[model samples]
Target: MPTTLPVGDVTSNGRTWRQSYAEDFTKPAALGTVASVYPGMGLYDGFQDTSGLGTYAPAKVLSVADGNLDFDFHSEDGRPLVAAVMPDGYAPHTTARVSIRYKTTVTDGYKFVGMLWPSSDEWNDGEIDWPESLTLGASPRPASAIPGTYANRHVKYDRSVQVHAKTDTTEYHVATTEWDTGIVRFYWDGELVSCTTEAVPTKPMRVTLQGETWTDHGAVPTDASGTVSVDWISIWN
Candidate 1:
């Protein structure tokens, strides 16, 4: 199993990749507060409104221990407390490969997502989401948005290319996404599960791991809670 980033070149899908960034969370620490500046990796530790269903209070939801980064989600004051973490300093990539080893507890009304989001924060620019689940235990899927699809304050994309893998979030799995010039590929446990060119994003983007709650699907119960653990993450460009 890959517990850490490759030291040198890594070969995958007949392509050579050089590691550009990685995090194993070996350093144990507590995220201070919302928007607190984490020294290592320049990580933004704080609240985020990624899904608009909850608040991402990293100080309350995130922690590093025993070489793993954990996201603990629960309700506070009738509002769900979720988590999101984004790395800084590394320039967004136009073409890159990302691998993450993670697992999650099956919790109703919650979702986990690993995505490459447009650095410009423009919805029309494009986005790539892999190993994304609308609810825990459901099959994971890869979804992408084609550039210039934003209109009337809503985002749309080609759903024809979306595909899912028969895997559960309770078990640790290495999920990977390869974004090339005009195509994107999704892999689970090193097996290709989906490939799409229709909604492949062309603009530079950065990765974010998020724990989200649901509002439309169902209201998150006050007692709903779970933890998402990431053993490590690696990025190549």
Candidate 2:
């Protein structure tokens, strides 16, 4: 049930964007959280495995590159990339619009997969798994396709990931999503790429980024220290 509420620019409840939504990453808290980290200079936090939620797993740190404090995660200790949703809480019957900017460096199948996983689990904060709305997608056959059971399925949220291949040093680009009930829409560089309404997730969620090994692309995240980096991330409720 997509609500008729109005949404705003930056951050909003439906019609208005919240000021905090467009916040710039700064010192200290800028790094977000690291599981086992070491803060230095512009990077305030370090990978502190024992530190818990606020910290990401796999002794990683937020480093500055290309005039931005981007996060580089490519290690066994590095936890699954995830973001936190403020206590403000998202509204019901409204759409959750999220946008993110990042760059990847890959070489093979290490599928550069980014998602909105529940920070609690990815960061080892709690036992609850992050609800997959746009990440999971819907589970019904599309009307446009021939009406019949087929091994090939059509999901409401058919999301595709981007890769920044190891050492490619190219800005894979930013993307946005609109989660409305059973539907999940995707946009890259402000252009709509997909619109799905399949296995829709209904719950509070967070942002996530990942680059795991994959054979489909015949690439894998090199076993290096820094393989992927993130420039900026935000969500418009």
Candidate 3:
């Protein structure tokens, strides 16, 4: 089944997250079974990868080889995760509900974080900073293991809840972002996890995936053995 990557009418300083991605890059270029590059092995051509990105870096692929799409995130500078673009020209002020059966992990002595961006470039581009990210599964406030923040002025959506990733274990879960007229709501597996309904962006935007190794305010790593994956990604009205 061909997945439809979704985008929205949101922008940031005329430079949404899509500034790095290009057009016709979201749909799966390679389908069915594929191989993946591994560390210590370094781009093995015969390791039986799930799927390969048409090009590496700056772009990641969602392979169904494992009954899910794997966005092989690496420890690269600048481009942490894949920030691809979707179709533009969303009806002005139209509400868009973006959902995906996606999950992430930060297992190998690092921090794990994901993102949802929106933009208006026909080149299928965009990236919006989260006003904030709320933590559900196994994190707490005042001292979060899986911390969520922003680079620009955007803040983390969900801060603290009860969602915690077991050290060295892969967690398969679902996350969603409800974006519409000036407000965005985030949910986890059909549950209302968190929501931001104020000070929404007045422009269009695109979808983005970002994960990295971050410190917990000079504290112990909640999830150190960093590695996260998403089974699938989809969007709807």
Model 3 ranges with Cα > 4 A deviation: 1-64, 73-94, 106-113, 118-170, 215-225
- Per-residue alpha-carbon lDDT of candidate 1 for residues 18-99, written as tens digits (9 for 90 to 100): 7888877767766553234345343434454555668867778887777778888898898888877774443688888989
Give Cα-based local distance difference scores for all models: 0.78, 0.36, 0.35
Tens-digit lDDT track for model 3 on 49-125?
11221123323432433444454444333322322222222222233444444445533323333333333432222
lDDT for model 2 comes to 0.36
RMSD of 3: 11.8
Which candidate wins on lDDT? Answer: 1
Best by TM-score: 1
Error of 2 at 99 (Å): 0.9
Least accurate 10 contiguous residues by lDDT in model 3: 37-46
What is the overall TM-score of model 2 with all chains considered together?
A: 0.49
Using lDDT as the measure, name the better of candidate 1 and candidate 3: 1
The global Cα lDDT (0 to 1) of model 1 is 0.78
